[model samples]
Target: MNSTTQATLIKVPAVTLGFWIIKILATTLGETGGDAVSMSMALGYLISSALFMLLFVAMVLWQIRATDFQPLRYWATILASTTVGTTLADFATRSLGIGYGGGSLLLLTLLGLTLFCWQRLLGTIDITSVSNTKAQLFYWLTIMFSQTLGTALGDWTADSTDLGYLFAAGVFSGLLLFIVLLAYFSHISRTALFWAAFVLTRPLGAVVGDFLDKPLAQGGLELSRYSASAALLTSMLLLIILLPQRAALKTH
Candidate 1:
């Protein structure tokens, strides 16, 4: 790695209320935007996934090549992953004729495999050590799989388990709350808790997004997906503009 590259490591954001709010909003926007292209615009899941995957690759390349962390660029990459996740999950569940249960199971297995391989190769799952190219690659790959898994898990809970979208969202949110408690009060491994919380947030966002757009009979507010996505996008943009996004300090 270059001297500059060695100085720049991917660090987790401070665990704050604002961070969680932005994360949930980003995930919700991911669901609505992904659905807009794949379902509302009549594009098949395969095509949508391909398009978003390409976009994700480009954004990740840009992020990885940058000398230092840029919050806008980093978050853009995150959004791309979520969009790709949505389409990939939809393809597996609907297009491939896998029911929600099967899709969730398949994604869960893939997620576990990714984590296993990553750990075997890297020896650690610490985000603080993600200063090198290989570590960053593994980090992003794990994120993609987790997001896809979240989509399927969300749908399985809402549809197959008959929990309803609102209730499913509540369940995930409650789990997130527990993670927060663990982080603050318990002596759990921070790395493990971080990944668990990160994975759970995706599904929480999915369920909340569904609850907003689905039919009244399905326990949703029945809002327009496009409008909700637009609003969320606008909010994110405004926050990015208003907040002070500083790069991580270079370590010796």
Candidate 2:
């Protein structure tokens, strides 16, 4: 592909083991980093949500303007989604008094609607087809919804359902593993499985972050949120440096 043609290709990284690893790291950081601002610093969910939203918007715009898939830019956008998702979910559930159940249901509904609209408009919601501006917009919207839904779902499993953090993390992680199996062994739709796996990873990260930071009295390690966030960010950066991230090759 020539320069212009290559430039028109999807500006997103292909899905791979490395992709998922970074995703989990980003989500985990989103959880702890968001809590650091909102809980530790007492910014409250609304203010923290507002702050993260600004970051998300800025990162997304930067990604949109790029000519090709840059690992740093793409992953930064993903991280922004997780951070914003954390606070937005918390605000919906805790501050808004929707509870985890209500917030999750609402987020799920919104996610379903976004996917439905994207599929209806493009006739497919596969990441492989996310090359154009509108499709990219839809793609990011789906991601934001999934991230927010993940937080609420994770909190619901851990707190509302009384499953506790470890169990909740286990549940999400098991679901992700099942999705991976289906992707490899089953004839299920790859696109559907991809989305399912994407959504499940967030909850796993959410619970893990909570387990790290919550008090011992609440069955947590009570680690410092800033410390956990920094550790996760470092790990993600190192992995990004070690891994090769490239956009999907245009085969069609």
Identify the leading candidate in terms of TM-score: 2
Query: Model 1: residues >4 Å from true position, as ranges?
Result: 1-7, 11-15, 247-252
Please write out the lDDT profile of model 1 over residues 104-208, one tens digit for every residue: 888888888877887899887777667678878888888898888898889888988999998898899899899989988999987799889889999998988
Every candidate's lDDT: 0.83, 0.91
Poorest stretch of ten by lDDT in candidate 2: 1-10
Q: TM-score, each model? A: 0.91, 0.96
Model 1: colliding residue pairs: none
What would the per-residue lDDT of candidate 2 be over residues 159-243, giving only the tens digit for each residue?
A: 9888999999889888998998998899999889999999999999999999999999887899999999999999999999999
Considering every candidate listed, which one attains the maximal lDDT? 2
Candidate 2 segments exceeding 4 Å error? 1-8, 250-252
Residue 68 miss distance in model 2 (angstroms): 0.5
